[model samples]
Target chain A: MSPRGRRPAGSPDAREAILAAARTAFARDGYRTSLRGVARGAGVDPALVHHYFRDRAELFAEAVVASAAGTGAVDISERAQAISRLAPEELGEGIVRSFVGLWDGLGGDRFSAVIRAAMSNDESLAPFRDFIVTGILGNIMDKLAPDRPELRGQLIAGQLIGFGVVRWLARLDEVASLDIEEAVALIAPTIQRYATGELPSSAA
Target chain B: MSPRGRRPAGSPDAREAILAAARTAFARDGYRTSLRGVARGAGVDPALVHHYFRDRAELFAEAVVASAAGTGAVDISERAQAISRLAPEELGEGIVRSFVGLWDGLGGDRFSAVIRAAMSNDESLAPFRDFIVTGILGNIMDKLAPDRPELRGQLIAGQLIGFGVVRWLARLDEVASLDIEEAVALIAPTIQRYATGELPSSAA
Candidate 1:
């Protein structure tokens, strides 16, 4: 059942209040927390939340994107362009440095919360995954390597997801404590190879 | 509070029964699923479940590992030994192949469930993280690169985690459809560089 089902007594600031509450709820308890709880937290009637957002998943997506935009934290388009402009040899390092900067700037708790929210279920995860695929990786592939763009994009996506798990979730000491430059130095070339080098022959 | 507080009526088969039930519950519902439910599913007293396992976290861990062992799916030690025996240059490819084989052999649903359980929360994730660090990556680092063991181990961990997300979680078309040998060809060199190459200078 949709937690935000119908309109209730509305106020001028009701939408904003609900969005703010959503951010807090998602950050604190993840996607499974009900919108009724969010509405109560925002001091709004649950129906008013339905007026602003179509459903829980949309509310979550909008809330995360809004907060990210508010902080100027979701500028993936600009970052994708920057990555694309780098020399072929530097592309991997460039990608690594930019992402490290982005996640570091977001801090662990908020970023992990967002990741956890996205991973909660397929419905919540779809938009985030799409943003990564079509928005970030697809854009980069369009400019960097036009051939086999899908494969290259998946490679990059896998690389970053893996990196994120170790660095953020597992908090492996060496990876966690790495200086940004040192991490880029170690990881960039691997990305670079994926970006520009030939895939090794399976027959070899 | 510890769910498994004390031993209940002991049967020779009780421990295995609890573990089997835990494996089913965790694989079906992940870390968020209740231990009491597992007990009910096992047809054992809830106290009996607590007696056999320390808590939900331990129950989940023992359950996953036991199932892996039962299926001959957790051969990380043997894989580690084989990785160690390889030349440094070959270590990366060897690792990629071994892991891809291991996960592929486990099938998507079970492997993804394990990952989802680990990612559900830090507490639930610790033993799995430790197994990767000490049991898997640490063992490989000891033989592949003795000097920078910690850093090398984290790199390997990150690489594998990223790969798993794409192949299992994201289920990206290209990554999911990749043949094991082809995947090794594409990913091994990146791992190789992490295993043996010099860390890049930030200014470079």
Candidate 2:
């Protein structure tokens, strides 16, 4: 069934409001946020939240995706479209530019909130992990990479995740201070290698 | 003056005790840990912790390094020496192998504690940041890389940090489930390129 078909009849606005409230709560409290608090924030009944989302984990996953796509930041779908348009060789630079832009646009607190929340509790981590591995990177790899797309997507994820941790979360001087272009220049090749370049023979 | 000269004459064991206590406390409470509590854990007066280390930050830093070294896990210094001994082209594989081994040996909890603590507070992040940028990666670059060591080291740091985050912290299946040698084969070349391969012209 279509996702729209699954929804209970009501104004779609309530759903959006709950998602928006969830984004704020998850960003502020990580995974520990309560559905009642989210419902109150959205001015909806707690039962309505349960109506929209199966549980808190589902809510958090939806909230994170909504936060990434719905906030003033660049939309992930649009960003994915932009990435898809780039020549295969240019994918590295395009991905890095898009990633840096997305995070920079989202602001550090929001970005860190996603990571810190994931790190704070393993159960909370599952949705974010799925969002990253399958929803984002894996989808990109499936479209673009020629071989071993799963590994390629994962390697790219590792590079980008590390870049975010070092530059944004850890705020290391050498990396955190680099201008976007400089970072793109230095990191894009590595990503390019992961995305399309030849990898060493796997021992496994 | 020598470090020993500054210390009050006493058994060397007290200094070690404070550091051990600090490691446990920092791992448990992160940067929010207090000197009095660490001192209590060590069976030493808070004044004694002050005498051995300048402040909480320094103590935390020392404790981290010591934990990396003193635990049954592989020592950072010895790991560095091993990396230094490898041929330049082999550096990537050696480094990845060492990193995976070290983290695996240290066990996930301790490794996560260091990263989680850093993420918890900006003040706590500084010492760990410095340790990653300067103490470990930068030092490696200085001794081994032929040019642009700072940028190379930072890039390498970003990659390794990402790998750890993805593999250990996030536990994404594609990368996380790989045998260590598989990881080494896939990632080492990327590290090698950053270590010695030609980088794109800097925008700066």
Candidate 1: segments with Cα more than 4 A from true spot: A1-73, A202-204, B1-62, B65-73, B201-204
- Fnat of each candidate: 0.73, 0.78
- Worst lDDT run of 10 residues, candidate 2 chain B, spans B1-10
Q: Per-residue lDDT tens digits of candidate 2, residues B26-107?
A: 7667655778988778776678898877555456557875464344333665566567677887888888999888888776
Q: Please give the distance, in angstroms, between residue A181's alpha carbon in candidate 2 and its true position after superposition.
A: 2.2
lDDT by residue (tens digit), candidate 1, A54-154: 55545754677646434433555667777878777778878998988987777755556666666766666655666566656765775455556678778
**Candidate with the greatest lDDT versus the true structure:** 2
CA shift at B204, candidate 2, in angstroms? Answer: 7.4
- Name the top DockQ candidate: 2
